[model samples]
Target: MLSEKTVKDLIDNALEERSDLFLIDLKVNPDNKISVVIDGDNGVTVEDCMFMSRGIENNLDREEVDFSLDVASSGATSPLINTRQYKKNIGRTLAVKAKPDLKFEGELTDVDEAGVTLEWKTKEPKPVGKGKITVNKQAKIMYDDILEAKVIIKF
Candidate 1:
């Protein structure tokens, strides 16, 4: 059987050559089907995926492992798992689900080592008035508190 560690090492070496890319997921089934998912700071392209696939394929010996490999980029709507992903998406809108059933939909304004800040405007009742008012709101969500986060693609 093909070892996962060996495959991981191969991928790590490949990523070293492409500093902008990062690994999102890797799976090796019992039947030796390896699936590699990758993402990039500036987003992933088909050529990037091909490069990664070749890096792995060129290193492995087909006669010895008899394995199949599939390399793909993380989809645009996929959940953001890495902090770098958040940084690249700074100006885009995101839908975030946090702890305690908290949910937020807003533009990602900032990202730091600790968390991200989302900003949006909403209509709310005025503090001492009879009518509603447009209020700007922001939320800071730490990485630990994030249950899921996805980019909101606008058409």
Candidate 2:
């Protein structure tokens, strides 16, 4: 079986040459099938995926170990898995699900290793007025509180 570390080293080497790229997920099956998902600070293109695939292929020896590799961008629909991804998505809308069935949609404002802060609008009663008004509020969500989070596409 092909080791994940060997494949990761190759991918890391290739990524080192590209400053914007980062690894999202790497999976190696018992049958020697490797799936590598990557993302970028700006965004990843099809050409980038092709380039990474070719680079990995060039480094590995097919005769020594038979393996199939699939390199792809962590597409728009994939859930956000890391802080880098959240930082990249700053200013974009995200649908976040938290514990105890809590869910909301908001614009990602900031991100760090600890968590992310989101800005959203909600209806609240004004202190001087009897009627409710729309107010912008921010929420800080820790990584542990997030059950799932994905970018919301606006058409």
Candidate 3:
């Protein structure tokens, strides 16, 4: 069985050669199956995945380790997992699930070490009018408040 540290070292070496590439997740099953998920600032391409796969394949001795590897990009619909992911997604629409049965959509305006700022619209009653008016609002959401968040694709 290949150690996780060894696998990480191999992947890290590959990423060191590439700019703007980050690892999202890495899993090594007991059956010697390794899965690696990666993302990039400009988005990851098939060639990038191939490059990472080849890098690991070349570093590890398949005959000795008896392992299977799978490397893939964190797709558009995948949930944002870290601060880097949130930062990269700035200026994009996100579907945020803050709590059970609580969800909202907003434009990600900014991200800091503590949390993210979102811009959204809400309907409020006007002071002198009978009808409600649309009001643009901004909210700061802490990282702890988020259960899941993903970029909303607009066609």
Q: For every model shown, what is its TM-score relative to the native structure?
A: 0.97, 0.92, 0.94
lDDT of 2 by residue, 73-135 (tens): 999999999788998899999999988788879999999888888899999987895999999
Clashing residue pairs in candidate 2 (N, C-alpha, C atoms within 3 angstroms): none
Write candidate 3's Cα lDDT for 58-150 as tens digits: 999977889999999999999999788998999999988885466879999999988888899999999895999999988788888889999
**Model 2: how far residue 96 lies from native, Å:** 0.7
What TM-score does candidate 2 get on C-alpha atoms? 0.92
- Displacement of residue 97 (Cα, Å) in model 1 is 0.6
The positional error of residue 135 in candidate 2, measured at the CA in angstroms, is 1.8
Task: For each candidate in turn, give its C-alpha RMSD to the true structure in angstroms.
Answer: 0.9, 1.6, 1.4
Tens-place lDDT per residue, model 1, 1-155, is 88889899999999999999999999999999999999999889999999999988999999887989999988998999999899999999999999989999999999999999999999999899599999999999999999999999999
Question: Which order, best to worst by TM-score?
Answer: 1, 3, 2
Instruction: Tell me the TM-score of model 3.
Output: 0.94
Better of 2 and 3 by lDDT: 2
Cα lDDT, all candidates: 0.95, 0.92, 0.91
Order of candidate numbers by lDDT, starting with the best:
1, 2, 3
